[model samples]
Target: MSQAMRSEVAESWHRSAAAGVDVGAESSPITLPEDDLVEYRAAHALAPVYPLLDDALGEAARACDALLALSDHQGQLLWVTGTTQTLRRAEAIGFVEGASWDERLAGTNAPGTSLVLDRPTMVVGAEHYRESVRPWNCAAAPIHDPITGRILGVLDVTGGPDVASPQTMAMVRTAARLAESELTRLGGPIPVPHMIDGEVFVRADVTVQCLGRREAVLTVRGKAQVLSRRHSEILALLATSPRGLAGDELALLLYEGDVPATSTLRAEMNRLRGLLGEEVIGSRPYRLLVPVAGDWNLVRALLAAGDVVAAMRHYAGPVLPHSDAPGVVALRENLHGELRATIVASDQADLMAAWTRASWGADDYEVWTAQRDLLPATSPLQPLVRSQLARLDLEFA
Candidate 1:
């Protein structure tokens, strides 16, 4: 019997292949050291939910000869339990605790794909991108932090074809919800900042979101202020440069070759200060008094730490998308270019797929080319890839 993948699963396979995953090759799974794994178990926020998750899924797992696995948001498997034979088989494939099963690492599978899709998913037979994993089927769903709605981890049930049905998917989804409910019940109230007065949050379209809109919101001491174009530009510059910029330097950076009048700049700064309170901005050279967190910084930090997946997740668009300010423009271009270059150089199909899906990379020729090159010649995506390449060729020509 010929096995066909569903559209979603097919797309996941395309993404997995593009990530440079070897379908026939068996790469050793990377696992945390025993000591580190122990610490991770202790510190993981989902630790408490384990008992409840086990209780909820244990009977079903035993009955179906399936394994119940839990992974962190990063797709690092933290726990794995099942019947004796199931455990033995799973361990051979590195489905043990502390192993990373991120799609980037493990290709298209239940837990990894669930993290990427942030929903319940079933990967059946060849739908598992790796040939070795195709013998088993699995259903998985992401668990979210109840308060922030951020993905905390994934819950998965893996076995033979029996576990690939919609019923199994529902079971996993219910288990995930139960885990989240347990987490919330035990977590007490969501922790709120003791003082919102001095703390400030700046949300730049590029920094706060992945859509890369050209707007910003500045919040201080629980009050929110929508920044004007000029104000956002100024605040963005100050936030990135902690050392401060002198009046002349600020004018040049803000206006490029045509510097704004010193008086105009001063008035704008005054208005901005009035809007955000006096303590938020320092006058020695224009700079932010309180630390500001932005998506751009988060991306850079993640990139520096070599977590390209997380970095790409945070990157929505170019910095200060509409800013023609000389310094802002330069900074924006540098960051954008660096991120693209890194993705291309990494040649991870999953990362490329992720980038191509973003607003910035939607039409990026280089990334698309990379994705096409990584795919198998007989892949279902070949025709689509060729069409995209042809269009790009004509457009560039």
Candidate 2:
């Protein structure tokens, strides 16, 4: 290795050793059990990108005697694909699914170091912190969610020292981009609003639906997990508070009148930790450690951008209709009022007509009246709009 390259590896090795990674260890740590591994992969939203990644790097693996691997942001190997001989070689080195390859577990290596550095990295033979893995070389790049700009995982090509070439690094980087592009195509465009100083914003892994009965469908990397009602409220509160909330503050936000016992809250959070992984929620001032895409936030951003139509599409319903928690109630009314006002204030007859027909707006007398007035006498919608207005008038009377 070049002197500069040796210095880089040495620095990483020092850090790994400090983190209690055993340099002389024979194998990486197995932090995930078989069942948990299945759940982890299933919950990861990036699973959809595997096929694209394989397609992009499969031929290279076949020709170069290399293995194409994908690991979650935590450095756990999610999938490994390559020739039978290469697979056998990787298995001998304990490079298999469910293995924790993070630098703290596996010592200095391409995938783990790339994650820590948040950049592309190459580790050649003898550069690996563990002597057991010193025979193999790997190049890896981090893949990020295009919508939220969150690191989803790493894409790597592993083989002999020949795989450490500039060309191999470029291939891994390109494959990472290809996977990200596929993710972007699937998620559609989510406009991130510009933030001024003192303003707080949070991104979500999935859209939180608080309308009616509170529920959240958490999608990370493409894997979806429908959160329980309590989990939905907990996530919603934390996702909105960028600086996080203390135990007392969170309890007040989650409960009404008498706050729940601290033990109850702790137990709930513990269960949530298991489902979301330990890295998602933090202690002390509890907060979401990752970006989340809440439907409420999307609506607010869309409305701010003057895209009322798009905002309406994202408005599933009121935010947590059953929750009487002060914060949640305030958020619910604010969003509901803003959206209704935007629709009523809009001059577009088509938009008013569209809103009046939706489940949320079906009973909106103002929108129905506006639609009635805007439609021509010969228009079929005029009759329906007028009838809706008359019915609303009778109910109010």
Candidate 3:
């Protein structure tokens, strides 16, 4: 209510939160892996008409400093093309071939929400459900089978704020209708676009470095500044809450002793607003006005891409190691555990050694064992590893 969010968008946000989508998720999941993607795409109902769709939207998207994307009825991105600069930037959010734009998984987005509502739609900055995607704006319209009228896919134009205009949505809708007419002219049972089967983010304005520090170091507009512990905690809570939090909920997470008055939480928020500026925060259910990210985002992104070495390089200790706030504790442990699991699975001696040398990893029994198994008898790390293993055995005993 601090800002005017469209009713359709507001409803989508509530549905997204209800579905348990992660607000910090970096990108759409790649539902169409390489295995059958080529074959499936070649035979898809929308496949034959894609060239026409591209021609209709490609020039306009490029002119607008944006990319033209096509997604299946279930919201899997099948094609994404545009100028090299725009494509490169779009890659930061995995806005490429084979990624799913499903609302339940990727949250409220142009491609996903258009399919959900089965109509032309646009999503602008800060209206997005996930933080990493809040910087960009997009407009999309559903492509349908002319005979049956069931949705076949989505046609979208994604770029900066300029893409959110009514004109852009109208263009996309027109392009989609052209594709549908082409499909009608071609004429046949498309069949698989909707009925066939199942299953399954990047740059932000505000960056908060919550890892390896008690209080967060927030960087905005190219200046790095540290926030008070209270402010940092508030930021952390708001950053993670998918739908934002109510006043009473925030109070419960913040206080440890006897519950304080709601006025106390409001007073703290007032001070926080003064420090961070009013534009960065929202009310009703307290939320962030801009897309937010933490340092840990880099490490997880690397890990997910199968780059264990790069992931290890960016793993900068635990998140807010000293904070006892329930939400912070959960995120801290979950991130640490996820990273540790990925490291152990990699089974690379150098990677394990790198982790074992870190203070937090020194006491890790699983990693030490994995490292020991990978090392040779003459390895220089042998003696140190042996001593640590012995110390760990006795320490545990």
Best model number under TM-score: 1
Order the candidates by TM-score, highest first: 1, 2, 3
For each of the candidates, give the backbone clash count.
6, 11, 2
lDDT value for model 3: 0.78
Which digits, one per residue and each the tens of the lDDT, describe model 2 over residues 1-397? 4455566676577446534566678887776777877766765667777887888897787688988889876788988888898888888767988788987678899998888667899999888988889989999999976655445788989998679799999989998988888877877323222331111234555445555555666777667778887888888888789899999899988888888799988998999989988888898988888776676886787788776754664466788877777778788899999988897787655556546655677888888777666556766456667788889889997
The residue pairs found clashing in candidate 3 are: 26-201, 27-201
lDDT of 1 by residue, 16-43 (tens): 7666667775643766767877776666
Candidate 3 lDDT over 105-202, as tens digits, reads 88889998887676799988899989889999999999865543446789999999778788898889899888977876776325553233321013
Ranking by lDDT: 3, 2, 1
Q: How far is candidate 1 from the true structure (C-alpha RMSD, Å)?
A: 6.9
Candidate 3 off by > 4 Å: 1-201
Q: Rate residue 285 of model 2 by lDDT.
A: 86
Question: How close is every model to the real structure, measured as TM-score?
Answer: 0.68, 0.50, 0.49
Task: Summing lDDT over every window of 10 consecutive residues in candidate 2, give the lowest-scoring window.
Answer: 191-200
